[model samples]
Target: MSAAAGAEAWGLAGLASNDPGDIHFDIVLRGYDREQVDERLRFLGDELATAEQALAAARERTAGLEEELASARGELERRVPDPDVGFGNRVEKILRLAEEEAAEIRQRAGTRPRRSSSRPGPRPSSSTPCAMMSSSGCVAPRTCSTSTSTRPGSPTDSRGGSPERRVAWSPRTGED
Candidate 1:
């Protein structure tokens, strides 16, 4: 099935039952990058779960508010007796219609197919040279060293494969 259709069908229950081991990828020398793919899938699953929970909470809150409104209306009707058959009769009719409409709305909301917005993939870190460097100049490797420090010769992140500080070296001049 298409991803949109699958998403529509899969609720929290389906997601809970899904076994990551059941997933199969085309095998080459190393298959797909297992770690990266798994991490992205895990992130997507988490986002889906969060969205589902939010929807459920919103539904519960709405149901509570509807019940409260009905109760308040009932209490108001009981405390104030309708002496006049004209104004009170019209008000009563309107309330009855409103209640019916609310019931219909609730029914439709319950039966309608739910659609969750798809979240975009994880973004590349801005601290990376590939992301920060201007497109007009050199294209650095994505795995290039990254550091949060503002000054030159600052310590790079652990992922850069170097324990030493990253020096700002000019490729042409070979000077730091």
Candidate 2:
């Protein structure tokens, strides 16, 4: 019939003519020698033992490295200074800057005169009627009252007006 059928028929005829039990026993004895099987088993056992020893050695090395790292970190902590102990140095720096500013202010105040003397006459006293003239010749009438509502460190004659009215002092100008 077909090629597969023909091969299957031949295989069945060969199985019917031969004793299957005898063929299987002969194949098993030829494929497996007792001494060779024992030797292979012993070799596998030796390889497993070698692998276990290597694993143990690796674990011991890892543990030793961890202990050494901890010891080194402990020594470093003892050698380095603590940050909390440096607070006094920071306070000293702030106080030094404050003292320098105060000394500079005192020196400037001592060197400069209190009032400028370039005006035409004596400064207008409080309770006098004064008229302020603008740069464009526009005059505005202002009352000079002796009021205590004066700005601190201002040169106003108790009238909320200063002699240098046109001057605007700013720290960015850097002028004395």
Candidate models: Cα lDDT each:
0.50, 0.50
lDDT of 1 by residue, 1-176 (tens): 43334433543222222467644444457776564355446646776887899999999999999999999999999988767866888677666655765587569759987432122222232332322133354333333332223223223322332222233322332331
Query: Candidates' TM-scores?
Result: 0.31, 0.37
lDDT of 2 by residue, 12-66 (tens): 2222212435221113546854543444344446657778999999999999999
Instruction: Tell me model 1's lDDT, rounded to 2 decimals.
Output: 0.50
Query: Judged by lDDT against the true structure, how good is candidate 2?
Result: 0.50
Model 1 root-mean-square deviation: 45.3
Instruction: Check candidate 2 and list the clashing pairs.
Output: none
- List candidate 1 stretches off by more than 4 Å: 1-28, 83-176
